[model samples]
Target: MAFHRIFVLDLAGVGMGEAPDANRFQSVGADTIGHVAQQWPGDLSLPTLQRLGFGNIRITNPIPGIPPVEQPTGYFGRLHMAAQDNRRATGLREMWDYTGPIRTESVFTTLTAAGYSVTLAGPFLSYLATQTPAERFQVGTNQAAFQILYDRLNAPVSGLTYVVLPEFRFAGEQQDLEASAQALQMTDQHLAQVIHDLGANDLLILTATHAADQTFGPTPTREYLPLLVYSPSRQAGHALGIRRTLADVGATVLENYGVAPATTGHSLLNELTQ
Candidate 1:
């Protein structure tokens, strides 16, 4: 199914569990979602994510309230950070395959060259917009960011929209489980609207740049990030398994628009569509 629009929601610092090399970074047993769920005073409801296969990523050890459903409406998976450090900048760079100091090439550039209008919205746009050719909307809050995305989706041009939500990250940094739970609820509500507004040719991806498990301390934890994919055109949802690198995301988007990836990652488009 060829999508006319693609939306990548970067839920920054929303990690699932510790990565393979978690001990090397002194972040062993760091699970952002797990800790948040366990400590959330009451039931932490995230119906939208649950329906999108959020709970399917971890079968053996599932999130408290968001258990794996029998039939999810989207694809679920995990992604390992390819960069040595778990910094947001490095994660974003790796996603677009930006390796050089002077970042000129990326998935955004490739999409632009392919005649796809790309819009980037988030509080941390400066970290990425300066390096890419996509239109930038530096929003201070998630509401404003989603508004820009909604506007872009209504626009006539076929394009890609990237949004970053830092609520979870902020809450995690503060080690506030209540705040984290609230952020999840609020974001899930917003996501519900996005899901409802999605066109048949629209694809939505929810992921995180790195893990910021509050249980692991104030610094970013080395952990596996969640990958959730949904499209109105998809017939059924399935597990996408664990992706090796974040670059696979860029590769999938480029392939969707008939563009070759300029980075070092395989595309999951085939698995997504087939």
Candidate 2:
């Protein structure tokens, strides 16, 4: 099941939620995709991500410029983080199925150990923040930084290319709604290049680390995170019919390389194998 390459882009601090414990976290009104769109006159337009089945994910609220496709090119869905803490570390660890105490290894660590060249960029926080890889670049704390690197690379990138985009929630926390929306748009542009240059066997993953707040509409509400996966050589499947949690991310990544999954989550990639 080993693939030639896997790239995971973390859109930090974005959420589309109905979190299981939203009420308790005072985030019951959070909707990263919807709230941002509400600011603009029309839905946020992202034709690039749209073609990748970004809009195909099932949700009560959909993002602008990405309405569900009649037929999607990749696996699409949303995932709840499965906890109320909602910290960046917590969400990232969930992807690795790290259930605490035993201190499980991360997907990044595992991949690096298995000899995959891993590169991390931008201000996107990492649960395995301590692990240095074969190569690394500092993209600072902005969305545009990542885009700059993406353009420089221009050609198809190999290895586990993990890039973290700026957190819209940071701007949202300052109640600078416009700035947050602009940041989201910037990431969309970066993604367009990614979708355009994907190699035949490369795997692409675009997801939020956690649902960070964007004013909560001057009040409070629940939280939700977005999840998406694309493979240029996908063998099967379309929209994910069932709800998914972040744990599935780790499972799917491991499964792609024929590694055994943790006892926790199941692989959504199962639907895409030829």
Candidate 3:
């Protein structure tokens, strides 16, 4: 059977549980989509990567460093502080692209190779502020954007689509467990809408790259991560245990569509489809 479409919702840096009473945070490399694809179940991850059809695209990874870069040696060195602040305002995309390592393949590219059309969607902070200028002082979440994205995704596209929604991007500096839960709810609600619109015959997969209780070191660092999967095409269960590595996502997807992933990962597709 030829799988027609696929949709993925990727919420960046959405840590697991509640925020900790700590100072800094760490961003483990495995949490990114690329790493997740590497661990897909079976050997499907490899051939799939070759079929991605993205061409020779050079995607940049993000990096983080200070004191070493521009030590306050002189006036210009002091100005680096302001430069760092500007970097923060640009949003996490650049951060991940510049400082983050290329540990895994792109999730978007992998899915495309698997023969499923995909569409990644997300909201950047600066863009959100611009959209709702009046709500500059007020905190913003992906609730509204999630609704719009879900509606669009479920609106009967010509083929399968992958949509990534970084709910964490909407949560600004407010790092709280409630924020994480709210982000999940926001994701579920939009997904529910899509499922309702598409019906049970269509496939639905839900998962997270990693979880964060708080920052590790005021910058990104290697840390523990978790992954979740919910597919109507699979089993009907609520509140399943978390997967340690995000790579399992690829394996599970391949199994669901009857195509083996090219990489190695835990394939919970059996449980999900069970």
Off by over 4 Å in 2: 58-60, 97-103, 124-128, 141-158, 167-169, 217-222, 235-237, 242-244
Best candidate per lDDT, number? 1
lDDT (10s digit) by residue, model 3, range 150-253: 65456665333333455553332443434444554455455556554644445544333333333332222233222333333443333334343344555545
Q: Per-residue alpha-carbon lDDT of model 1 for 1-274, expressed as tens digits?
A: 2788999999888899999999888998999999989987676789999999999999999898889999999999999987788776788888876443455467887778777898887776666766466788888767777788778777867888998886766776787777877888888998988988898889999998878888777778989999999998897799999998998888888778877643577888888763
Which RMSD values do the candidates have, in order?
Answer: 2.1, 3.4, 17.5
* Winner on lDDT (1 vs 2): 1
Considering only N, C-alpha and C atoms within 3 Å, which residue pairs clash in candidate 2?
17-223, 17-224, 27-221, 27-222, 28-221, 28-222, 29-220, 29-221, 29-222
Candidate 1: give its CA RMSD in angstroms. 2.1
Clashes of 1: 0
Between the candidate structures 1 and 2, which one is better when assessed by TM-score?
1
Which lDDT tens digits does candidate 2 get at residues 147-184? 64565345454456767665554575566667777876
* TM-score, candidate number 2: 0.83
Who is ahead in TM-score, 2 or 3? 2
Error of 1 at 155 (Å): 1.7
